[model samples]
Target: MSVNNVRNIYCVGWNYRLHAQELGNTVPESPIIFTKPTHALVEMTGQEIPFPADQGSLHYEAELVLVIGKAYRPGIRVDELVDRMALGLDMTLRDKQNEVKKQGRPWLSCKGFLRSALITKTLPFPGIDNLGKTEFVLQKNNQEVQRGNASLMVFAPQTLVDYIGSRYGLDAGDLIFTGTPVGVGPVNHGDHLALYWGEKQLGECTVQLG
Candidate 1:
């Protein structure tokens, strides 16, 4: 299947209250939405991600990813939509992001860069809402770094689905990066990161400093 033309990459920012506190932001009244160009998508298990050299720091965000299987418009009930996913990384340019945020400009510069986003295999399974339990963890160099469960989310997956749907029409091939939990930090050159769901390996990749 041609993975190009990724319709949209919907991202939730600071959905975890602790993550917000770390970044010095309060919990949002609604889901914070952002977009990454389709070109940014890369398979973490097979590709090398270029670390931003000019930026002061490149951060790793471990998130639960939802891959949409069908088209959806705004206002659709979260229970009615089906999402396939596991967990993936949402890499970011922290210095660049802070600069842009200070300028009150859109986060495009911080979020949209070639190979800036990564995903594991698109495992098709039950929709996210149907999953009774959701857990996520990230390890770097075999060291546990970040841990979070779906229960910590300020808004559930259903709420996220419905909120974004009301504003943008979600279609097949689109992916959603739910907000990350605390423990986000920088990744150094040659750092190996592994993502896991329970006992299964979701994916892994190495970082090359640019």
Candidate 2:
């Protein structure tokens, strides 16, 4: 019963150059998407992630959540499209994403929060265009900081669904957190975040403060 309408939420900032030098930004060439509102997707563990006390840091970007099942745009390629894969949680706010890039604004307060993109439950791959060499991971309370694969994504994942459907148009429960690697930081208050792809742990949460 999960995997319902999640509308747009394609995020892929600094695909991973140590998260673009921790935020300084560089290696781009393509996908650098951003967006997160569909009610900020709350509770999606088995269900229940209501943590938000005010916000100061709260970071953790262990993503691999591409779940689109239809609807396309932007010169559709990669053998058309159709998805159903899993794992989510792209929560961030590192000081409101460093004051929205110092000032250039727009990132909706470090990625529209509330429950901040937390999903899973739609697992039916053979689609998602294979996701070029998948193999991701990121743990906290357990150890293992961050691991990478997806061929060190520098804008892959079908080029971020064809450059974000050629400018926002990917429908059918849109979602695509395909980023994160090079150990990101922050995640206090109870911290227990966990995620995996190759070994298939897919979900885990506990960070409470907001």
Candidate 3:
């Protein structure tokens, strides 16, 4: 599927236990939901992500992305909602995020920016039964930088889809970022980022600091 088809970009924060603890945050009882505009979407193949000129502290968050196939109403089953899967990068402005957190403000500027949502091509989703065995990895400069399994998620993908759907009905072209794992860090110019699902390499791209 093309990135241009995505209508909504929903993201969950601190869904991984180690990721929460790494940033000194307590595990949430419910998913922490945020959103990025559709324009933020960027394909991973041979793409260059320009660093946000306004923010000095930028970070990379590797995540499992779910593509909604059927329109979801309240109380929809997770198995029926997801059509495809992919690996993605939830690029963030850490300094801006922290500032907003201190003032109790929303994270629009911190989380939603141009080319902030980078994704690999969609793969066939084997259904919710395969979730437990699913794993994703992120490589930076040819070395493993971050990795996580579905088992480590505080809020599973099914739970998130159900919960989020209850509050906001999901449409067919919506993409949900299941959240990042522990090894998230800053990115610089000329850095290479590669993402994988299980043993299958998904996508690779380079960073272009502006």
Candidate 4:
């Protein structure tokens, strides 16, 4: 399914222990939730992604994205919520994000910009029992930069769905970005970024700066 069909793009932060430590953050006991509006949706169509002209230090966060096919109430099970899976990029304006954080403010500006959410085409869901075997790898400029597995996630997909649902019931078209792994770094003009599930290339996009 197309990301355009999604209503809300939910995101979890610091969900990977090593990633949290890499950024000098303490691991949270519960999930740190945030969101991106639908307007931020961007398809990984092998085109150049125009960088936001006003910002610098655009960072790439490779994540596992879950596509919800069934409407889930507070008590819904994980198996009933996920319809498919895909690799996604949670693009961030890092400099702006830090500035806002220093001032103790909400920083949607760093995350919720046009074409900020880049995703691959959805593939059939790997059942919860097999999630531990799922893995993600990211390449920038043709070099491997990040790698992670679902087994390393502090809050597994099931727990994330349950926690998010108890507070806010999810609709059939909701999308969840399950957070990034370590080695997230900046991308510059003319750089290429690619995401993969094992050796299978899922999506790739170029960075365009003006």
The TM-score values for the models, in the order shown, are 0.92, 0.32, 0.96, 0.96
Q: Say which prediction, candidate 1 or candidate 4, comes out ahead on TM-score.
A: 4
- Write the residue-wise lDDT of candidate 3 on 10-60 in tens digits: 999999999999988999998999999998899899667687665878999
- Poorly placed runs, candidate 4 (over 4 Å): none
Per-structure clash totals for the candidates: 3, 0, 0, 0
Clashes of 4: 0
Candidate 4 residue pairs in clash (backbone atoms < 3 Å): none
Model 4 quality (TM-score): 0.96
Tell how far residue 141 is off in model 1, in angstroms: 0.5
lDDT (tens digit, per residue) of candidate 2 on 78-127:
44565567767678878877877878889877778767777655566554
Q: Residue 82 deviation, candidate 3, in Å? A: 0.7
Query: What is the lDDT of every predicted structure here?
Result: 0.80, 0.71, 0.89, 0.88
RMSD of each: 1.9, 15.2, 1.2, 1.1
Candidate 2 residue runs with Cα over 4 Å from true position: 1-9, 12-32, 35-56, 60-64, 67-80, 96-98, 105-122, 125-163, 168-175, 178-186, 194-201, 205-210
Quote model 1's TM-score: 0.92
With candidate 3 superimposed using the best TM-score fit, by how many Å does residue 102's alpha carbon deviate from the native? 0.5
